[model samples]
Each structure stands twice: as C-alpha cells, then as structure tokens.
Target: MIKNEANARHLREANKAFKAIKSEKPMTDYAKAQQSIQENRERLKAERLAREVSSKDAAK
Candidate 1:
C-alpha cells in the first residue's frame, strides 16, 4: 500500500513537471517529457508488483 502511494506521488510529480515544461516557450522538449513518462512507468510497475505480491500472500 505504501509503495502504491509512493508511486502515485511520483506520477503526480511527473505530471506536474510535464505540464510545466509544456507551458514553457514555443518549443516543447520531447526528451524531458519522455524521461518523465518513463519514470512514471517504472513507478507504476513497482506498484503493480507490490500489489501482486500482497494479493498472492493474502490468497495463501
């Protein structure tokens, strides 16, 4: 649960960063957006793994 929450927090932060970058000058930085997206994906994967483990333990 804690890991899930942390992951969510990271995602939210990434979203904010994306928005900020998007709102900047005319040119948008695809690299920064891509990095943030990748980080978000990794965090989500960690959260999913944690949930899977917890669920499996509960089932047992």
Candidate 2:
C-alpha cells in the first residue's frame, strides 16, 4: 500500500525529469547550429572585404 504509493511517486518524478531533459536537447542543438552559421557568415564577409581592399591597393 504505502510502498506501492512511494514507487509510483518515484516513477512519476523520474518521468518528469526525463521529459524535461529530452525537450531541451533539440533547442540546445538548434541554438548551437545557429551560432555556428552566424560565425561562418561573419568570417566570409570579412574575407571578401579584405580581398576587395587588397585588389584595390594592388591596382593603385
């Protein structure tokens, strides 16, 4: 009776924790991917500008 109730409570708590952890995983991964893409874009833009500046200097 009491033991059964305790077991049920433990199971419920474990399930809730599992759900919370599972739900956050996709959001965390998406945020990391978005950050990586943003960093890559910034790096590409900087490189393009640097090349343009170098070409102009060479022309002068």
Per-model clash counts, in order, read: 0, 0
Per-residue lDDT tens digits for candidate 2, residues 1-60, read 999999999999999887754344445788999999999999999999999999999999
Looking at model 1, report the run of 10 residues with the lowest lDDT sum.
19-28
List TM-score per model, in order: 0.53, 0.54
> Mind giving the per-residue lDDT tens digits that candidate 1 earns over 1-60?
999999999999999887755455553599779889999999999999999999999999
Model 2 alpha-carbon drift over 4 Å, by segment: 1-27
The global C-alpha lDDT for each of the candidates, from Candidate 1 onward, is 0.90, 0.90
Candidate with the greatest lDDT versus the true structure: 2
List pairs with backbone clashes in candidate 1. none
